[model samples]
Target: MSTSSHHRPRDLRLDFFRGLGMFIIFVAHVPENSWTLWIPARFGFSDATEIFVFCSGMASAIAFGAAFRRHGWWIGFARTAFRVWQVYWAHIALFMVTVALLLVFDRINPSVEYTERLYVIPFFEDTASAFLGLMTLTYVPNYFDILPMYLVILAMMPFVIALARISEAVALAGIGILWLFATSGYLNLPAEPWSDREWFFNPFAWQLVFFTGFAFMSGWLKPPPVNRWLIGLAIAILVVTVPFAHRWGWQNAEWIFEARDLVWGGLEKTDFGVLRYVHFLALAYVAWVAAGEGGRRLAGGGAWGRFVAITRKVGQQSLAIFLTGMVLAQVMGMVLDLIGRNMLTWALVNLSGFLILIATAYGVAWFKSQPWRKPSAAEASGSRSGAQGRAEPVSRRSELAAGE
Candidate 1:
């Protein structure tokens, strides 16, 4: 009943973990990068994608929920629509920019096959239809699919907010039904022009993770309590699933890997499969207990805190960070090929990408801080700005494309 509840201090936990996921995503995206062999996804049913989506959902609850509570459902829908507009354009821009980068790099060194590597050559071969699909969001290459899925999922916010009004069960039912239909393959968006292939990350199915985070953050679902037994169970689930999701330390046992599909079954990353969903919830719960709400355990005035501060900054500017990282991942892969992939070069490429991601975060923060407008004479001269002048914008984004 109160918008005030939706308004609260920034949650550092969301920012810190999201920042971690951003880095993991960069490492994973780079082709043939050995570092990817160690990322969380290699060891579990879910990976950085879950982190990105769930945190986004939590962030959206803050970003959009207040509008629904304070203004009206129509106004809330307007706000959500405006965000979808922004994300749609961001998707277009990222694809265009990336395609241009790939072409430039390929022109310099065709042997690397940069464009063909990502299947972007198809876009060039059929530029007219491809451009049409890009503009309409129908020709989503796998590398470019995440934002489109996010855009579609974000557009569903009005319905989620509306259903929450009737009852929490109704809200959950609405979410569950959508996810089920999508999982059954009855619902999906076309990702390419020539075939019936669906988007790499189907928004309807993915919305389950997105809205679960939304539900908890919006108080529609009670937060899970930390318990010793639950902790043990979560740990067991994570360890037991490693063999199924990945084949590590088992170089001679290829059959064990093949047998996994039958034993555990259907944990497809594409559909937001049931096991992926459960696995991520368990991972999130353990992280929640460890971070101790708002990530209070992560606070201090020393070097550890400094590292945490940098991570939170990255999380805060995720939209920009993600766009930059995605492009850099491709570039880094090309660079690795150019220099010859090795332990030394691999380390350098990975570290350099992280640095760039960090820089993007800080740069975005500087812009979002809006330093361009001239300061008042007193503020310009280093006097304390009045509280009203210093207050954060109420319209600040919540996370991902939902940055706050």
Candidate 2:
């Protein structure tokens, strides 16, 4: 690959939106918050999960696809494999910590009802099987399923990249067919111990959104010029959908204008329902038009620029920040249960949690930026000798491309 290809600058828009999504995820994860009422999910068919998955797909393509194009298929495959391993370990570690937290909470207040709600009751009842299931990715608790789904998608990314290389249309067609089958509920991976249960975010279906981002980043799909009519149409749809947002605010709230099932299927998050997908597309179009060049320019300087910088850092080190957010959210939930839930408590917890998450992101960024110590002359000589002794040749380009 040419140096220019490898040196392409990152898109500020992606980083900004991804950082925004991270904040939204943190808020959404902590339930019973007044802020949760105002999350985009309350007004639309989709939530932060879509943004996270889609952006992740785009990021993966840019990072791994470049490697495949520059080095070789195997190198890219190795990179993808490493990512899957990283996510798998992260998920497991998060699970262990979460379990520990819940156990502690239970000991503090046995009647708090944290066990059954968090879906760790099985872990207490059947420790051996539950522990095994967790390790095998079958005992996924609520809010913990997203990473596993992402893991599956990243694991299959090498093949997706190769297929796109061959023919974008064919690759996308295959993905569409899989998505259609998944949506029809004919195809799904079953949760073993929980026989009737399926993965919360189905990979087969959600891959459509993921690969859509991948295709766009890989240059297989070119974004169309912002059209005024499309923006108007999107705005109109959002206005029409405002009534649907009421369901979130009030329990058993009747729709002001109900439509037939044939016109729009109900929102099914697992399968990425047709209505939700279309709603997301409409939202994306409107956002693109609204942001325009002003959004790009804002990244240069000002209050918005600093905001973007912080978010971009959070987005860059999303995994660590996300894990921290999940654990923190649970802690906040426990605090609320003990003290009681109210507007003041909600505001304090969320505001404090957001600050902590931002600090964690900055910490990761600072750590990453720290300079490494140079090896001593003797150590350098030994390293050179070891490299010479190795049979397989190592590519310096591949070494530089280790992490993205």
Candidate 3:
């Protein structure tokens, strides 16, 4: 229950699923990638966004919540604030790199307006106000809204933790109230100054998903029992809803989309619509059941196990990979746009993106391992004798792998 217990084992499934979500998110972000047609979003009401927010909340609970319990409230809030600061800088970096690259490409290919495509032009057009808004987060573009929403939630973690200290019901009630206000369209931060629009991922609405994961991981809620009936219902929810979500069905049978909108009161992703929540929980349950205890399905010695471990690495250093993935996705989108999207181009871009993400994960892991630090005599001898990264202390490795 305490971060002082440094050797605590992590459930590999968390990293595995979160890493898988990162990869899927990469696929989803690239503009017009054919592979995107088959992503979870296309098959159900929810997508990798759910996977990300939910898993991130669980990771936060594991990393921050336990610390709060052991070290006290202020320390836990400090850790969360530090993470928010890191993510804030990462967001700025993501935007800068993306805009710079797009401008460079646009200069070369005068026929294409890449900046306009992603809505980066407004910043250049009105640098004074737009830059101020960007810095203040008053003009959050659609593509760059994720971090703003994320940091807002991180800023609220202390309140939730403080509430849980008093009573779990009070914390849950707080979360529910926000969800109600936001989903009802009464609560949200303004995204841009031009007219009237709210943040794409409304923190108030999305906190429901985040806190659900937090509650489970913090032991506020028990894991659902694995029963045949539960599994059946989850499967049915996934299977029966596919046609309504699939691109082919939307093209061939338009009513499915309309029906979906009607059934969920609009299925609006911005507000974290009802059907999306249910569908994501069902999918998450099925995945949780399949991973089994201690991620037995993903842990073991073999080819598949090794691949699973690699994916978990990607998940462990998710923030770096996510930033890299977003920028790389835009690069791949430019490549695809120039070359045109055929089956071969799609496969190459998607596979190369995945490899780059994997490499990013390992690279970030090496950096987080803090190679600049001095080593023990045994480590020094091993280093002189051709040893590499494997010499890092077990606890440090566990800590890095458990949280990003």
Candidate 4:
């Protein structure tokens, strides 16, 4: 089951897929773009949330798992805790910026409707309570909940790694129990200022998928060989499900059982239902078979290589780019609201937003690449002195996404 021998210096595939998920998220979040019709969610049971969460788990395993192995518990815990802190602040910053943007837009364009949505309405009516909730991780606005969910996951990494050290089976069983509890409504995490509501992405249930990714990447769980039959079945499910996903097909076939009815009362995104999780597993398997090596090759010439480079850069700076996209998406929504929602407006906003993301990625990549200054002789001597007593710096491949 060991995959250490199979590990690459860097998995470009992780970066490429994660960056692609970011793009999908940006497009999908745009209020009413025609382009959204073609995103993965329309064709299958899972969407970018699945991709993002799962990849993040894998990345976390690569990052924090390695630290635990090399630096022992304290250092690993510190690193994981540091990341949780980063994500916590990023979430708060995004919330404040989003609220400011909406308030300013509402003030400037008095006639334009902006804060009337269910999620936005709360902030305007009860600023004090909402602000309190935001500080407490309970007032997550729409499109702003994922980071908080991820923060919870990162906060648990030390415990997960500790349990895995005793026995991988034990760690997985614990994770499974929690997932079941969440899925069955036996466990719930409450949201403040909205006592009746819970987190949109229930970390309790979703942690199973996240831990699955982490375990697989950390060699605690080996991915089964790709099965042709399974692949065919997955493809068949996707094909059969597509018609139900579209307006034309749903309109034409009233006789067929509704897609939601086919699965035990349909898959629920918040709970990460059984069908939804299974679909993502199937999709991930097929994607692995199809792109694992091909992606590596692509990373190495030509147009595809260039594409891979850009995405890898974005993936490397995932936190910054994701936060930027969240803010930009809101701004784009305002523009569309003011100009009217036409194909031209949608195209302009989406295209401009996407380009901004790519540019941000390139900018981060350039910044990380800069050699600010060589250490002075005394500083170099101090560094060498310190190296003898500590673990080596974490490799770039093992560095988790900043906010992950």
Candidate 5:
């Protein structure tokens, strides 16, 4: 790695985006109630998942950048593998706790076949498929695990980092081709196979966004000369696409939100649809511009910071907070089902889900700060990286056991 490869440690903009992504993820999944439904698609924006995936990719770049620079590629691989394992165990623990709670409640009083669809039936159906998936670290159908894509990005980090070093232009060109395929569904790529499974995200397609974020951190895609035209172009794209999206949903095939049926023509998450991609890219651009000017100030040292600080906390402890929110949401849905809430009631109750998310994030942040475990590897790496140089710091990779 070139000393020229050496750059700043942490980028506040990336943190801002991660926090923003978490907030969007919260809103998108909260529920379709009155408080939210009326918010309008334009305001509601693209599916938040795109931003999350992109940010994760950017994080991989930053995290793996240092490791690749210091240790060899093997160390980076070992560390990434460990992080993948961490995410998997975290996911499994969440699943077990959720099933136990639901089962305990159901045992208190018998329940129906569906009973909230807590776990995927197929996960237990065949030992071969399930075992293969687990061993390969593949996604478990349509639950809330983002680990699969993150892991894939981690695996690809060396390529991305090497490309970043070789030529920023070459890396960006590769990203462009991937984006075209993801957006248009043109090519049957390595990441998004023709399998009928519903992935949380297809890493092949998502790599475009992720690598783009990496480039951003690597100074390949710095905020374009901020001008009236650039801002105008971004806004125009959103204005034109928003209503069109309403007329024809991103994936007409995904009429019922069936993950397998979704077919995206653009940057959509359903298939990495185009509108979703552009919308998120636009938002990202805006964030970048704002961060460049000043930290995208959610708040300062006063009362406002105290308030926005909650969101920042959520951003900081994203993974733990995300898993907690998923479990809580599922539990809440089960409770609502038991109460026999009508559609209207169910929607209203969804707000509680968002509240639960914020509360969980805040709570988890507080808990992690206690004197038990040391600060997360990501956090510690972040602190050290910041001491290194000027550019923004991306998320850190998990540490690996030696001799992997």
Candidate 6:
């Protein structure tokens, strides 16, 4: 195991999973003045949100588990809560920066297109309100986005982490119930009405995959010692389900759409439809198996390995890198819109945008490595104590009042 893994360092596989998720995000969200849609759909890998959110739960479990083990729940919970808040603020800053950029550009050069206008209005107007609503759990913004769910996970982290520590079965059961209810639409989450998002991710429905990942870390779901037969079975299942899903009438099931739209049927972008879930799990299995067997050779370790190494670094500082990627992707889209390209030019621009996004993430990761001064003894002790204080369970009344 890597030294970082000893400290219960972040999972490299999880980082790789998140990196893969961002690639799908680019595919789904990248502006389409031309083609590039059919291929993502044909493979049934287009909708990336479900996979991303599922992985988030798993990553949270691993990260918090390490913290919980090292320092009691109080310190562990405090650190996790603080990190979530950091991500929240980072998201807010990203939203504001994009809005500010769009507004400035609009003033300099007005346009007939609604894309930039749509983007700008969300940040300056309703999106501002939406952020506020999210903090209170009263509203969710961008039904297609993960911010709301992310915040909810943050709020519930104490209970969730505690449960994971006690019994993996209990955690799995809790997630399963949430998944069942959300997918069934049994529990209606009153998101903001104006958004009218066809449910990008009903957390209740997707929790199964997430918690299953947690099980993986807790020794509950070990990769069955990779037998050739099992590998064959997994691949066979994928081959059978994917094409069957595409051809059979099952692809467009209403039960799944009712729960969430992205993955139920065909390869739609945002909603968490059933087919999408199948495809995500299939890919995840393949990745896991490959990694288990020194497939590190396939990914490379020379210059290319160095590059993958960079991704791991960015993975280490994921919160900062993710926000940077989002902002950069949006900015790149705006630039392309301004260029007013022909078909060939548009294709090249799209490709360029994708490369730039990847490169920028690499750059941010590289930058984060610079050495910094260590905290003094007293400062470190005080910081540690503060974290412990936050971790301590508050009175039931305090928890209730905070929620209110």
List candidate 6 stretches off by more than 4 Å: 1-12, 33-42, 114-139, 193-199, 240-275, 292-295, 341-351, 370-404
Compared to the true structure, candidate 5 yields what TM-score? 0.71
1-404, model 1: which lDDT tens digit per residue?
01123332336788888999999999999989999989999898899999999989888888888788889999999999999999999999999898899988898777878888898887878899989988988899999989998989999989887888888899899999999999888999898787788899999999999998888888888776678999999988998887767765234467766666564435877788889988898898888778765556877779999998999999888888899999999899889888999999999999999998998899888888897686877776564544534543533432334752
- Angstrom error of the Cα, residue 381, model 2: value is 25
At residue 42, candidate 5 shows an lDDT of 36
Q: What tens-digit string does per-residue lDDT give for candidate 4 at 1-404? A: 12342365336677777898888888887766777988889877789999888888888877788888889999999999999999999988887788778778888778865666425777768889888888897787756789988989888779988888899999999999998889988776667666778888888888888988888888888766657887788677767767765556767886543645666424788888887887788788777766744354545588877888888777777888898888888788878878998779888999898899999988877788774676878999999878854644554334655536
Which structure among the candidates has the greatest lDDT? 3
Candidate 4 wrong stretches, greater than 4 Å: 247-252, 255-259, 262-266, 292-297, 374-404
Write the residue-wise lDDT of candidate 6 on 1-404 in tens digits.
12233322236656665765665565455454443444334444424555566667667766776787789999987887887787677656665675566566566457633334444444346766766754554454452246655555555667766776788677667766665566555754555545644444455555555665656665556545567886787677566555434423245666543444443344333334455566766666666677654334336668967656655554555555456556655565566667775777667766775566567776665566553566878899999999878776565567889899
Worst 10 contiguous positions by lDDT, candidate 4 = 1-10
lDDT string for model 5 (345-398, tens) is 665566666566678777776787784577788899998877664333321222
Cα deviation of 69, candidate 2, in Å: 0.6
For each candidate, the alpha-carbon lDDT, in order, equals 0.85, 0.78, 0.86, 0.79, 0.59, 0.58
lDDT of 3 at 222: 74
lDDT per residue (tens digit) for residues 13-47 in model 2: 67667888889998988757778878888887777
Q: How does model 2 score by TM-score?
A: 0.86
Residue 251 error for model 4, in Å? 4.9
- Looking at candidate 5, what is the lDDT of residue 159? 70
Clashes of each: 6, 0, 0, 0, 18, 14
lDDT of 2 at 217: 74
The lowest-lDDT stretch of 10 consecutive residues in candidate 3 is 1-10
- Order of all candidates by TM-score, from best down to worst? 3, 1, 4, 2, 6, 5
Error of 1 at 204 (Å): 0.9
